[model samples]
Target: MSLPFSPQSSLHQRLRVGLGTMLVPLIMLAGGALISFEGAVGSFEQQDSISRQALFPLAEVEGEILELTSVATHAQPTNTMTLQNYRRKQLVIKSQLALLSDYFQGQPTKFNSVQEIRRQWLEIARLCEQIFEATEPEQLANAKVQLSQRLQGILKNTQELNYRLIAFQNEANFDKARAVREKVRYLVAFISLLALALALLFAFYLSRSITDPLQTLAKGVEKLGQGELHHRITLETQDEFNHLAETFNLMANQLEQSQQDLYRLATLDGLTEVYNRREFNRWLLVEIERSQRGEHPVSLIMVDIDHFKRLNDTYGHQAGDLALCEVAQLLQREVRPGDIVCRYGGEEFGVILPKATSADSWVIAERIRLAIAEKSVVLPSQQHIDMTASLGVATYPDHADCKERLVKQADQALYTAKYQGRNRVHSAEVNECNHQINKLQRMLVKQGT
Candidate 1:
């Protein structure tokens, strides 16, 4: 029979069960270890606190007492400043002893020692006071003897306390060192066992939970790389890997859409969204080859926006761009489905009419010119600008019979239309006289005819 909690269960259920089984024992072990360690640590901190706050202040007070005793013994009978110094030292020593009492309040033994020191200090202060009160030379000399004896007693007590604190501190250091050694050994053993258990659990969980899903995802990725854009990753565990699969599916969809958009951008113009110059050249070459094989005519019309620079200077470049786009839209609308419209260059456009003659191309060009002349482009400033265009038409097998020459002939015709006053359509056939004269000149050069 299968177990109640098995590998075939959901990843969340498996993870919950695994963590519950693993962490309970680990936490129990860690709790016991922490309690022991914290007790040792607390003892070490208390020793450190007593040494810094209590012992150091006690030493300072002892030094002050010695200084006061020396000053009291050597003071002249009328030197009031000596009494003031003695009073100041007495006050400082009392304050330090009070502070030490506060630090050792929790320990009855240490507090008792501080109380003993305070009692001895009070006796010494009383002797200093007696010396301050003595006025006669004989009285001052006797007070100095008593003050010296009181100082000796206080010094002996202070030395004893200092030695006790040092011994206690050394014992604390030894205990701290031993505790640290024991803690290190326990921690190493406990952590090694815990880590070993966790490593085994993790290895088992990873193989069950992650490895199969990742292998499936890897295969999906391989399929996607091989152009299986429609392929998707399906995971049912509802884990992070499931989320990753969903994101991967989204990325694949976006990539497929982006590829389509990129292909469209490659063949279309960025501004006018018509066939770009490169695409135009490619289409024209294909049309020319087909025309040559069929002995049929193919026409090309070249268009220019007349006074476009002046329009840009007058209204701004934005208006000029709008005008260009509007003109492209007009040409696209007027041209037949079989014809291809292209943005030839800056402020110029070309249309390829397959199986069309010069007359038909010229008529279409004239229609485009009229449409542009009637159209008004509204600028971003809410201003309208009217514009016009010049067109030139040329046909293959009648105008140079080759793609390059046909385009050149059309361009030349366009130049003539611009020179004859803008907003007009002209044809290469209308300029046949110039072509015949050039041909005769070439023949003359070749044969002296």
Candidate 2:
């Protein structure tokens, strides 16, 4: 006769069963340990609080009583001020006794002691009052003597009570300490036993289930470290380690994809999806060096949207963004394949033309300006808004030698275009002197040049 194979006999199931069986006991052990420690600590703290609340005030009461006794014995025909001082000390003693009573409310034993002390304190207070009321010199002297003797007796009793309280507190503290020590000893033994049992269970389970999977995983990790990203761990147990291996493979795939995505994001603008300012600068520097070495030309065109702020204020930012995107698309459509267009900044765009002369760049900029002027952006409100762009063209080694100077010249040209009129293209070569001379020549040429 043969029995059927159970899934519980599998390695994964055995691991789960073993961990589940141990987990509850381990948790119970930890919880019990924490509770025991907290109980011990709480007991110590409660005892200390009682000492501070009751015993400390009792000591203060004894001190105040002694001060009152000194005043009664030393004052010659005690004055009203001396009596007032004595009464004040008496009241302080009474208040402290009342507080002590409150502190020992639930405990009959401590409360009884507090009552006894209070009774003694009241007798001393009465003696003090009698000393204060005596008016005649002889009567005052006698009252003073009597109050001193009475205070001595009460002080003796109080010292004895204080000693007893100290002894009791010390004994209670010793008992608590012994109990805590025993608890710690028992807990240590229990923890040692529990740990030993758990260790044996872990050793058995690790030997049976984990060692081979860990070795395989280590090898797979080594392969991954060696750049073999396609390598994968194989495990037949279908346990957590198998799941972890699958996650590792997924992570590798995601890491590869993320690298490509990061590269694209770094090089391209988020909104316009064109070369960003950073990429444009990088390309411009490379193009400048190439032009310097080859003795060829590189051109830069700076374009600004005309009345963009007014457009934003009139139709809102959403409409303004649509206009900018439309302008970017027009620029992209007008430029050659080798030319790079970038959203240089808000309401501004830059075009980098490699190996293109100033004349070539001016023609391209004019075409871009005309295309942007013709295009109309449709808003979410179904309203069509026409927009225009001002463009400035400057070429490397022709307008300026370096990248920075060339960009500056182009920017100046763009400023001139905006100053002259909107929707126009201007070249950097047209300086103020050249412009004046050209104006005179144009006037003469109006007859025909």
TM-score winner among the candidates?
A: 1
Relative to the unseen true structure, what is the C-alpha lDDT of residue 300 in candidate 2, on a scale of 0 to 100?
Answer: 98
Model 1 TM-score, 2 decimals: 0.45
User: Which numbered prediction scores highest in lDDT against the true structure?
Assistant: 1
Off by over 4 Å in 2: 1-246, 430-449
lDDT of 1 by residue, 316-396 (tens): 888888988998899989999989999999999999999998888888988888998999999988888888888989998
Q: What is the C-alpha RMSD of each candidate to the true structure, in Å?
A: 25.8, 31.3
Residue pairs whose backbone atoms clash in candidate 1: none
Model 1: ten consecutive residues of lowest lDDT = 1-10
Candidate 2 local distance difference test against the native:
0.80
